[model samples]
Target: MKPNAAATAAALHYTIVPKDLAGHIFEVTLQIAAPAADGQVVSLPAWIPGSYLVRDFARHIVQIRASSGGKKLALKKLDKHSWQAAPCRAELTLTYQVYAWDLSVRAAHLDASHAFFNGSSVFLRAHGQEDQAHVLEILRPANVAGKSWRVATSLPELKAKRYGFGSYVAADYDELIDHPVECGDFLLATFEAHGVPHDFVINGKVPNLDIDRIVADLKPICEAQIALFEPRTKTAPMQRYVFMTMVVGDGYGGLEHRASTALICNRNDLPLTHQSEMSDGYRSFLGLCSHEYFHTWNVKRIKPAVFVDYDLRLENYTSLLWVFEGFTSYYDDLMLVRSGVIDEAAYFKLLAKTINTVTRGSGRFKQTVAESSFDAWTKYYRQDENSPNAIVSYYTKGSLVALALDLLLRTESAGKKSLDDVMRALWQKYGRDFYTRSTARQGLGEHEIAALIQGATGVDVARFLAKYVYGTADVPLAQLYAGFGMALDGAQASKASLGVKASRDAGDCKLAYVYEGRAAHLAGLSAQDVLIAINGLRVTAADVADGLHSAVGRYRIGETVELHAFRRDELLVVRAKLQADDMPALSFTVLEQAALLRPSWKKTTRR
Candidate 1:
């Protein structure tokens, strides 16, 4: 008979304290239940999942030591993140100090006012004892006294209040590391989704925040996702969920977890106390939230095969980000419309924005989505100024692939089968019993997609995947949009261009990125060039865009114009002819949209 997980598990206890708040250091003490007969080896993870690349977390360890049975044991460093201790018969104890300074969703950060950390940044995994239960004790900061400080996290409480300084428990090492903790004088609010409690914890200053609006806007989204996965029961997989946001002057992104998400957004992106109209920034923030929340099912649980058991020591490569991240990107904004927060017209506009962004870059023709996903660690995460000219984003183009598949499935099955069906099929087949039973720890592989789609929907999508996902062929958007009573109005009028993306910098127009094979590239106009004149006319950054466009306004295609710019302190002049560029500007309008009501899928593009 198998030993019970709760009863047979050895407990690993950890005590954490804000040792030096001004210096941003955390003092940690880990008590091991037992030590190895041989010397025990402990290692910190080289990287965290969801975000690719090796972070070398152990580099933050400032000091470390090991002891057992009240006697200090000799500790030796074994490589980067691993440490070995001499043989000990009694329970072992390890103490360390970590320097916390990174202020992003990926790592740990601490200041005099606030403290936050991910388990990957502080906890060291005990080799060969990963399945044992782990417990953490959060102590009140020694430096600060009576500051109304509170702890917020999704980790289960043992002898702690909901948001107090005390003990928390995790099923194992993996579960323990998945929940990030934030302690500060935060703004806290609570709401219930399908009777499950969700805590909203904000760590920055947003003046007169409209908490009701946030609760109202996010509640429907949470409920809809719950109903999507567990339709009959209307239940969520998590017992509790937390949305931990850090508001700043200007920042935006998020990272997902099992039952919680960490987000960073600009202060202006938050809705005010009585704001009626939705600003573009607020919409973008909502999209970011939706994207990360969708990962609760897509990437966090329904993971790529290689990620089922993450090998944190190295890069875990998979070509299925088109399904993991791409599909979630496609649904992030679409769910807003379906959930009644946004309208269909607004959704179509959002879709057009994505389409324009993807097509504007020249790299879509050079790199496939699969290649982009595979090289994400080296290329996407470490992008530079020439990124658009060399590589494509799996997130952007991958969403288009998902859109194409949704259209294909809906059209082929007469509106009876949509991407919704495919997702439900994915959950039922692979994700339903994932955490409930350890034996069914399965993830989707690259070779399994075509067969799975065919088996679930009785439609063969091998050619579709080959043309768009694995190959660099663009999806037939114009043809597909027409099938839904939408007209793709490709722009005929062109805008005057230097074939470069420039921004106003220090009263001068600076080229941010010069497209390859464009007029700017041919004229030797490099990125970082500051434009001062066009055809002997003075120009400043504020008016350079209009000035340069007006300077070449009268010139037709194939016409040449002179330009002056400074690359660093040196000045140069170059002449280049205008080229007819197919600006990726598509406008979607209503054609037979009058009949938007009661539309059928058994319709082809208006040929």
Candidate 2:
């Protein structure tokens, strides 16, 4: 079929104005050049892509009304998120008020200091005209009473200057919603990666930030990724990119888009002025950057079949998160080493941390990563205290799966092939130009993963998936490491175990997690148990460290100690025995001769 030239010519126009600062409201006006012959059905999405929770974004809509030719048209409620214009053939204009208060990447947030919003939260899809061009006019906040504001987004500016408040355009509705907007007096910087421009904008109160260090660390990682997928051309998929971040006191997460990613990091995670050393917090932030940047090719382009045409009204299920998300997890840190941000020793330590985290979780034996991905809507995203005992993280376990597969390929082919080959193949076959054709766009199936790996490296991994991904068998990390001349310390860090992890809450030492069949579990101790004393001595939240050691340090292994605790107003003395610590195995070190075979930043190749 040929393109609908007339429909595509008439664009859907939207104007977003920050109306109220204190009340946290944004006024949105959507105008269409033509309405449907019968009636136009307009609705807000239940949830956005990248974040898989049905958030019911339409609930934030406080009021709505429709009109044509300056005359009011009856608006009937079709459903929770849907609204219909009553038999209107004239051009439709819908004006709605949205209450924006959530402060996460998933939804919209507006305050006196700044404003940010995803299109899903403010722009209602013009039901029949989603394929047509969409125009957005971002109006300056009518309520702001502070410093001058600028805009930051990946959306193409039509009539506005770069980072200016004016008209912007998208090819279609999908592209329109994918570009999230931020308006504030933000700290901004620019850098070049493989000749494509990139922006780093942070909206927070961090003083004397080391922007040069972040740029220095991020440039090579971005260039490495650009070269990874397109080795011959070294071309990034996007014409330009942006990394919009919000720095808070204690926050960490990211959501990937086609041309940009929205991220939140703790202020301390950023390198301070004159700080040359890479702190753990800064390393973790860099890892987050790598993780989301890797998603540019994985989930955003090489998507699962189910996500190709997302149904925002309900849940979209897929069992191959271990491939998309898991593979990205594996490469997130690997890119750090490949880009020379960290040394081999540091990389090994990071790998060991992931290994110990996966193996220590009892949920690995109970739920496979495939099952976890499929049930992410109710299980993974909405987790409670029992989450650790019942479910495994697809991100952590998926990285293990990728590591095992990479090692297996390298070992089988004498380091001639690896997971890189598989990813590049997937990108060339499925992701490249995926969004160019809306009709019959291809996506990876559950079975195609195995076929691709076999074709790339001439190694079969059907049995591996059966036992580890779909089945709940643990991947033998130590055994696999031993083959590569690496030694894993399987010993626990200590011989003391309470079987319960504790944290401070309101100056009280409360149990955070109580494992099943452990010392705390067998002793009638539960989560949120506040410790009052041990062996008749008082203990507070701060004293748990020295207090716990002094309480059990005097006893030998298998000796019992009287534990006095408060379980929600019920005081009881329980006898708990000293047991071995369940701390994760650590200290993975490379042996002498095998160190020669380890890949380094300079050794990364297309093989």
The candidate maximizing lDDT is: 2
For all candidates, the clash counts are 0, 0
Candidate 2: pairs in clash: none
Please provide TM-scores, in order, for all candidate models, with all chains considered together: 0.93, 0.95
Give Cα-based local distance difference scores for all models. Answer: 0.83, 0.85
The digit string of per-residue lDDT tens for model 2 on 403-512 reads 88887887777778878889999998889888775568889986788888899889999999889999999887777777777787866445566777677777788877
> Model 2 compared with the native: what TM-score?
0.95
CA RMSD of each candidate after superposition: 3.6, 2.8
RMSD of 1: 3.6
Off by over 4 Å in 2: 1-9, 143-147, 544-555, 592-607
Worst 10 residues of 2 by lDDT: 595-604
Give the candidate number with the greatest TM-score.
2
